[model samples]
Target: MLKYLMLVVVFVGSSWVHPMHVSVCEINFNQKDHSLEFTHHIFIDDLEKSFRQSFNKPYLDINNPDVGKTTDELVAAYMKKHFKVTVNGKSALPKYLGHEVENDAIYTYMELDGVKTLSSIRIFNDVLTEVYDDQVNLVHVEIGEDISSMKLTPQRKIDELKF
Candidate 1:
């Protein structure tokens, strides 16, 4: 009995642990500006890996002086391919603003201008899904006082929120 218990402990201790694969996105409708502000929070390591794979680059250093511009370009292109938004059933491509690295995560900003009214929003966020099978993307939308949230996974990549 003691041998079996020891074996169980060893097996549990030696088991491989998978890293957490998740990204958070926040979309807010700015009534005064008539625009939809988008912010995405992603792990820096994961983003670098995805960028490397997508761009076929050997290395991507986030701290390099010249890397900021290249990183922004890569991020914008990646977002354009992986993330999308439709307001009131009309497809609107967001304008890439910029990105900032905070601690271990990267925050990407974008905007969809001329959004006068928002009745429904369709979001398709597949960031890192191609690389990580267990990737999960969480999205939160704030339209005035009303709010909506959705969880996107590999199987279900798109979700429509009605406000």
Candidate 2:
């Protein structure tokens, strides 16, 4: 009886100790608008920790007025530095639209306008790699009627897909 009790306690404790380090990014090529729409999903707590360490702030409130602007600026800078997309070997500068908190995660939106065609796409995603060693960034791209995906890590940060 005691052995079973110990095993249960250990299982519960271990489950709570480790947090999943993952982020998901979805990219859709809009044929009508000739644009690429990107959306990134990350845990809010993990993002808060990254922001706090980067900005040296005691606390970051996404809902607050002053902190909101600062958060947006930091997010934009971070996204530009860590996330990149290239179409047909030419780098496309994605404009950071905005971010919103949904439940326990934050969704950031970005778009690359005036993209004529997507013959080949190259993605470089390093989000949360600096903070977490085991971070995994998963990207799913939808172009026309086909879809391709890649998993990125610290060692392998870039992936290219040809359509």
Candidate 3:
């Protein structure tokens, strides 16, 4: 009976093990309009509710006075402000797209008006990597070493696939 119970526990526990150290975002740029589309995914240990509560406050009113002034409004404002973005060795200023996924950290989307050809942009303590092209459809995002070696199992077969 003990052996059977142990097997059951292991089976249940195995399904819960997910990658905890990685996050990813997809960015698309439209050079014709001088605009950029950004999709961000982050991996964290906390649940969606906690992540939302900690960062998104006041229920995120898009029309609020404190919200976006000149650029397209962003959903995860806190994440954008803290995360670093660079394009071709220069800073890339991004607007927000007001979508949020609180589970395992916030996954959101946004657009910036003045994006150009970029070489690379990295996020999540540099754990998520994106390489851009002349036209700006994200060429690839290389999930870093820290995430690959974590105890958590790969969430997708793509997770194990690398650049």
Candidate 4:
């Protein structure tokens, strides 16, 4: 009986382990032109591989900038177009995680999700830099803070289904 119970525990624990991550971001709202620029930094245990894979998405041109924007700016625009805040299919926004005001830049910690699926569309906002080239506003996103092990989502498991 004890042997069976021990086996069950091991199986459950091993299978339940998941990859969890922490995200840090900053939003620079230039009230002057009604534009918002954001910078996000993510820190995870395995950054090189995970960052590239997780953030890997198709590039999008919101309005076709004449001179093209930075990679970060482009990413920001793409996010705004595709991402939305929703809790159970309702509108939700990023909540304050923390903040730091430097001499020239004010870094804000706007966390999208403490717990979320890898494929989930959890955060979005306009990348002003994609618009006007002059005095262009921009949003930057970085993924690295801490990624821990947790239970995997049903969808993730299904997606990972192997033959």
Give each model a TM-score. Answer: 0.82, 0.83, 0.43, 0.26
The TM-score, computed over Cα atoms with residue i paired to residue i, of candidate 4 is 0.26
Ranking by lDDT: 1, 2, 3, 4
Question: For model 3, how does the per-residue alpha-carbon lDDT over 80-117 read when each residue is reduced to its tens digit?
Answer: 64444555555666766565534334455767676555
Please give the lDDT score at residue 62 for candidate 2.
Answer: 54
- In order of TM-score, best first, we have 2, 1, 3, 4
lDDT of each residue in 1-163, candidate 2, tens digit only:
4333533443344345536577878899999999999998777777777877776788876545255466678788889999999898998899999998766667899999998888899999999998899988988888776767888999999999988
In the range 1-163, model 4's lDDT, one tens digit per residue, is 4333533443334344513332223333333433334444322222222223444523322233223464335344444443334433335454444434332222344444433322222333222222212211212222233222212221221111111
Worst 10 residues of 2 by lDDT: 2-11
- Judge candidate 4 at residue 131 and give its lDDT: 26
The 0-to-1 C-alpha lDDT of every candidate, in the order given, reads 0.82, 0.81, 0.40, 0.32
Which lDDT tens digits does candidate 1 get at residues 6-99?
3334333333432567787889899999999999978777888886776577887755524446778878888999999989999989999999
At residue 82, give the lDDT of candidate 4. Answer: 30
In model 2, residue pairs whose N, Cα or C atoms come closer than 3 Å (at least 3 residues apart or on different chains), thus clashing, are none
Write out the backbone clash pairs for model 3. 24-41, 48-102, 74-96, 75-98, 97-110
The numbered model that scores best in lDDT is: 1
Best by TM-score: 2
Model 1 earns a TM-score of: 0.82
Better of 2 and 3 by TM-score: 2
